[model samples]
Target: MDHIEGEPCQDIEDCRLTDRHVQTLLNREADELARHFTGTFSPETVRDCVEDSYTHLAATARIRTHLPVLAARFARQRLEATAKNQGATMSDEPEVLFVCVHNAGRSQMAAALLDHHAAGRVTVRSAGSAPADTINPAVIEAMNEIGLDLTKEFPKPLTTEAVQAADVVITMGCGDACPIFPGKRYLDWQLDDPAGKDVDQVRPIRDEIDRRVRTLLDELVPSNA
Candidate 1:
């Protein structure tokens, strides 16, 4: 995963936080995560995941108020991926990861569409080489118009564990950023970036992604199978 150099605190409230305060919050989050991943991971591992997730998300976060919550969610995802990599959790469903430059537009759209179409038949994740602070508003609007909600979705940094856990890795435009591993299927979809575009402009891109997602779904989980 690419690291963006910066302090984690960017918002006004975040700027007011002391190092101790941030550490305390992270410790609390790690405790909760440790309980959730009890049998699968150790406390130290959980704490490290939490701290790393916080740093990754905090680097691009525009608001610090919800940093802990977001960090928890991100850490959980990474831990789950790590579990999959370590064979701690087994799944028959295919795991897919979508990567792009800024997880704000193309990658996010593809992930949501694939999840919707998969309907729990497949596991989906998305990340970026350089994540944005928030999801692209136009992408959100376009997805919403199709009955998919993305208001809670945020950009996530790409991670080695995420790639290692995935059975299929799709790259939108991040190009050479995604790490390659043997036996994993890789596909590059040349899609237009939705940043700075309005909802109308994003709709076509969303539809195209939907079409591609459906095609991929057929290959991964065929109707006959």
Candidate 2:
């Protein structure tokens, strides 16, 4: 589904962020560096900061990305910096996506890992270019060892729209079936799939994904400035 659209902002009543308004104009985003501050600033504080930061950033630079929200984040540091000066008004965290041949293994693990580490600081989702009927049983077993519940999640089909909706698109060997759009950065992870593997084998893969997920989270959205 399209996350945000080009709807004109009509006062605060229309300011909750709709798909239409969010994509309409490419305003100069505020220059704030999120990396400068970290360690659980209150939600209200972050929201305000992100808003003010985006305002300044929208005014300053041109973001290059097919997805509007995704593009908006490259300038995320700029927005955070602006908000910090004003004392904190961060709003909205970036969205992350994971992809693999089957949404059942690698992608699923990666998404869960990111979400677990980030708490509610980031939004995480995963899908397949070609989906499976359900997530891999072995993968699920491995994650459960760490106490994450994926019972409500399901395998989903991949769409260009979904990829465009993400700030980052991580592909686990999904070469050609996945298209490359302009203004998008791509990361190819060379990980083995655990679709038919036993829990012993799957455990190592799960641990690796979690480690990578934690590193990516820090590098991309560090809590400590």
- How well is each residue in 2-66 modelled by candidate 1, as lDDT tens digits? 32234444443443334677788988988998999999999999988888788778867866667
User: For candidate 1, what's the RMSD?
Assistant: 4.2
lDDT score of residue 78 within candidate 1: 95
Question: Which sections of candidate 2 miss by over 4 Å?
Answer: 1-91
Query: Runs in model 1 with CA error above 4 Å?
Result: 1-18
lDDT of 2 by residue, 1-225 (tens): 222233322233333334444435323221222233444344444445455433332322222133234334533433333443354554467667789986888999899989888988886777777666457888888888999876555555565555655667889988877667676557888998897799899998998888889988997787784
TM-score of each: 0.91, 0.59
Per-candidate RMSD, Å = 4.2, 13.4
The lDDT for every candidate, in the order shown, is 0.89, 0.63
Task: Report the poorest 10 consecutive residues by lDDT, candidate 1.
Answer: 1-10
For model 1, what is the alpha-carbon lDDT of residue 168?
98
Clashes of 2: 44
